[model samples]
Target: MGTLFRRKSRMVVVDFLPLPPVESKRLNKAISETGFCSRREADRFIEAGQVRVNGAVAGLGVKVTPDDKIEVNGEMISKEVPKIYLAFHKPVGITCTTDTSKKDNIIDYINFPERIFPIGRLDKPSEGLIFMTNDGDIVNKILRAGNNHEKEYIVNVNRKITQAFIRQMSNGVPILDTVTKKCRVERINDFTFRIILTQGLNRQIRRMCKHLGYEVTRLKRMRIMNISLGKLKPGQYRHFSPKELQEINQLLANSIKTEEASEN
Candidate 1:
């Protein structure tokens, strides 16, 4: 027993090197990861002193360690991985809302196992590719009007499109108390045109066409950002490939990095 004790003491000798302290992450991220709200909204909560970590009021810029207890509005947040991202080609006549009050909302058409909300929006009368995700972080990155994510559309009008109308659209049109941003427009057929817009105003295409005295019969968005609706029929959806997800994440990362660098 004496020998064994001696051996254990010898093995337990402390090292001279100091151990690294555990780093703390921002409280906003912890709340946002729970899928409750976006990081921006989380910051608002933090500023309002509505969040508590380890029985202390969580202030803005306060860091949270792994073992720390977190509570929001007196409710404990479950640390679970966020839900998956998805994209769907919304069919015409389907509203982009989750409210059941709307009889023809997109939520009724989706058969996914998880609750996913549309990232942005496509008008009920317009059919095209729409991204749906539980990740609120990516929504601002993708939908910021200043981000200039190009949206390509094929629009069918009732009458033949004139060169003057194309020029006006490509230059800029007045709508929503603001001048529409410059866009790319090309004639596809006698009454069809393909237009690519970098700005998304509410019912922009319809309002623009209305200003030109032309009624849009159909408007289909073929692309958003770098994701194309290719071969994905209307009213159908598929999981984003690994490569596609990587590309989108990279785009968002770059945008955030750029913004941070500019601020610094």
Candidate 2:
């Protein structure tokens, strides 16, 4: 397990590349793997002529070695440390932010021995399975539910559940500036229901409830894709198992995070 992390500082070193190396890192892949940005973003930057290698404009197909000086928008892109992926069951009232100044920020609450940040938000009033990772690039890949990843939630409403509400929620609810995509909503009890959403809108579920004239008394995320919030109490976390990580990698294998999907 010690091999997974380096005892030295978080700063990583880039080794010198051998001359005429058999293989070199592709510009987009190198930038994405460095956790600087998504590969989609890297490609866009290259297209916009914002990327440079050895002080020359780098195209999309350009390759880089350790000897190459890669820059974006005039700032050099450097090597990155290894990434960490964590699953956390956050308690209500903990803010999902990296800003340590926030009194109840999730970062300060978890206080992992190393630097890490929550992948997506669970909101201050809600709780449950939220991913914490040091890889910024993977954030878009996971959160872009347009790729068909599912996020399940259990909600308790202020009023008794109704078939009409379930049908409407399952069909779709018009909120914000656009209608929400169709999702699975089923009743669990008089005032409780389970919902699986494929789109992450800003305060989506809450807004949908308000529009239906129902108030959410409690909300808890049960799962994100294949990862479950099982046996995890509030303010608790665990490293993803090998099986879990393997399945996730398979799921994200062909998924590329684009700007359009990230807006969701």
Candidate 3:
């Protein structure tokens, strides 16, 4: 037989009996891991006394185990909920923001039943495939520019493309006070081209074009990593097939989730 006694900040086991390991984690992380909300939001809920664990109000820094009963706003939260992953074809003029008050925000436009946010954003003037997911961890994994995940785009410019332009773009163009990384740029026609980038500099494509004295008349993302836009029309979305999700997980297996790690 074994008994537990409180000794300062530690629990003492009498009789030196062995006990099964109780995997534990911070309460906020537990909630986030369940895909219910973000860790920040979980902290807010705890501070506001809206979160309870085992029928007692939870506090910040609380540690919880898988067996803990967690609740929020008088509703019990399951320890595990099916994760949602989506590929959305964003439309031009739609802002990729979660703020419902913002007009033309992607969240409101999609009107999904559950909370999901865009992995990364496209400019309001551009349109194409973007990822949406309740899995917050995967966002940083895939978005870390240093990971060298490929994002392919089709672009149309206001003027005819030239050989020099293609060479310059492929070699690397100076943008955002830094030189853009060398990438694969193929001329599709006099006015259109295909580009694949592993960098995510702000307005990179447009700025690169402007620096070369060309204006981007149209831009559309065609693929992200191993996922493709396929036939999804603007403002439409589809869940990732099991095979796609499996492949993405494999690709991100070694990805770092920190911004600092992504900086050159």
| Highest-lDDT candidate | 3
The lDDT for every candidate, in the order shown, is: 0.78, 0.83, 0.87
Error of 3 at 199 (Å): 0.9
lDDT of 3 by residue, 1-264 (tens): 768999999988888667889999999888876777756567888999999999999899999998999999998878777789999999999998777799999989999998777787898999999998877677777877889999999999999999999999999999878998999999999999999999888888999999999999999999999999999999999999999999999999999985421111
Model 1 residue 116 CA deviation in Å: 1.8
Compose the digit string of candidate 2's lDDT tens values, residues 144-253.
76687899999999999899999999988899888989999999999999999888887889999999999988999989999999999998899999999999999988
Give me candidate 2's TM-score against the actual structure.
Answer: 0.74
Please give the lDDT score at residue 106 for candidate 1.
79
lDDT score, candidate 1: 0.78
Q: Which rank order by TM-score, best down to worst?
A: 3, 1, 2
Which is better, 2 or 3, measured by TM-score?
Answer: 3
Q: What's the CA error at residue 193 for candidate 1, in Å?
A: 1.0
Deviating ranges (above 4 Å) for candidate 1 = 1-28, 36-77, 100-102, 256-264
By lDDT, the better pick of 1 and 2 is: 2
Give the lDDT ranking, best first.
Answer: 3, 2, 1
The count of backbone overlaps in candidate 2 is: 0
Error of 3 at 66 (Å): 3.3
Query: Who is ahead in lDDT, 1 or 3?
Result: 3
